[model samples]
Target: MKYVNEAYDFVNHAWSKGKIKKLIAPLEGLAYCTTVKGFKEVGLGVQPEESNYFNFFYPKGRFHDSLYGDDFPAEDLVSDCICEAVKQYIEGANSEFQVPFVRILIDLMSNPRFTYLRDGETEKKYVHVIPDDDNAYLLALRGEFLAKFHFGNKSDADDEYRAEFTSEEIDEMRKMSDLAIDWSKVNYESA
Candidate 1:
């Protein structure tokens, strides 16, 4: 059975933290390939709007590779894994999306499954931190303890432990973020 509280925590952090923007803040106007969350091939654009908030854009389905080291796209044949970013894929996407790109990458990076299988141990219960589409962080369990950090895709089983955003929640966040963002901070440019 899926744990609701765990899922909620994961999503809360994933939604609230601006991981993508934090990571991308340093790489303005750079061209790079992406494979995070099934998004492929990306080039991020950042320019401040009249209100002083930065406007970020990328192809409809693209993410940064390095920022999503843990959950970057896998080779599985299954297709179509859209996240909240999809809303911004449209031309002139709202500035509210400016934060999630980085947060999503941060969440994806947090899900690591490096096992420390011992020679004399078996059936050990383990726990892990995982992030999901709904922008939540949750705990993942395994037969044994594993390191919290790694650089590879997780098993199919791990996919089941994710949370998702309801259309309502996405809209709520979008609206809330629009109010919470302090545009003045986004006015500065990188050297």
Candidate 2:
């Protein structure tokens, strides 16, 4: 498909520019959001008018219709193309980097908090916070989570969603969350 070719071109150009490292976080985030949170589609676009950086878009619902009009590819098609593109990139990555990248992906996949969003919402009612007893605590926690991770800002939050985990577990979740940011831009020629 044309979208598949375009995705491959985008990834290959990133590889050539020595900027693929910047894509690691965004790609993993896309994968996590789709496979884990049930997002319909995710895309990488270079916004020259804005930051000139590649941004990942996983629109909540009909948002894509307004953004891309009727010409946008099917959701499943785009998802498959993204998966294929990521696979090809990982396969072609340097061995040293590949090992650590795979490790990070594995850790991320194993962490339930990495896929905290439900039905495209990360707010109070949508997020699955445990021990739903303390309303004030839940509101504060949700606010912190959204502010730090959702609003493109970074800040610490108490893990009151459940019984607190060990230090190591918390560290792993923090690392993955930190890596979940906007994709970095790349130079690619569309064929």
Candidate 2 C-alpha error for residue 77, in Å: 6.5
Give the lowest summed-lDDT range of ten residues in model 2: 136-145
Each candidate: RMSD: 24.6, 18.3
| Per-model TM-score versus the true fold | 0.16, 0.20
Model 2 misplaced regions, further than 4 Å: 1-67, 70-78, 81-85, 99-191
> Candidate 1, residues 1-191: lDDT per residue as tens digits?
11212222333346433543343345332223232222222222211222322211223323323322222222111111112222222222345545444454344333342112233232222112222223222222211222121212344444543222233433443365433433233221110
**What ranges in model 1 sit over 4 Å off?**
1-73, 77-92, 95-97, 109-191
Q: In candidate 2, which residue pairs get closer than 3 Å at backbone N, Cα or C atoms, i.e. clash?
A: 54-185
Find the candidate with the highest lDDT and give its number.
2
Q: How far off is model 1, as Cα RMSD?
A: 24.6
User: Model 1 has how many clashing residue pairs?
Assistant: 11
Q: Report model 1's TM-score to 2 decimal places.
A: 0.16
Report the C-alpha lDDT of model 2 over 1-191, residue by residue, as the tens digit: 22333444545555553454454435533433323233323222211122121212334421122222222333433345454545555575766545444454455344432222345332212111222223211111222113122221123253332222233433443467454422232111111
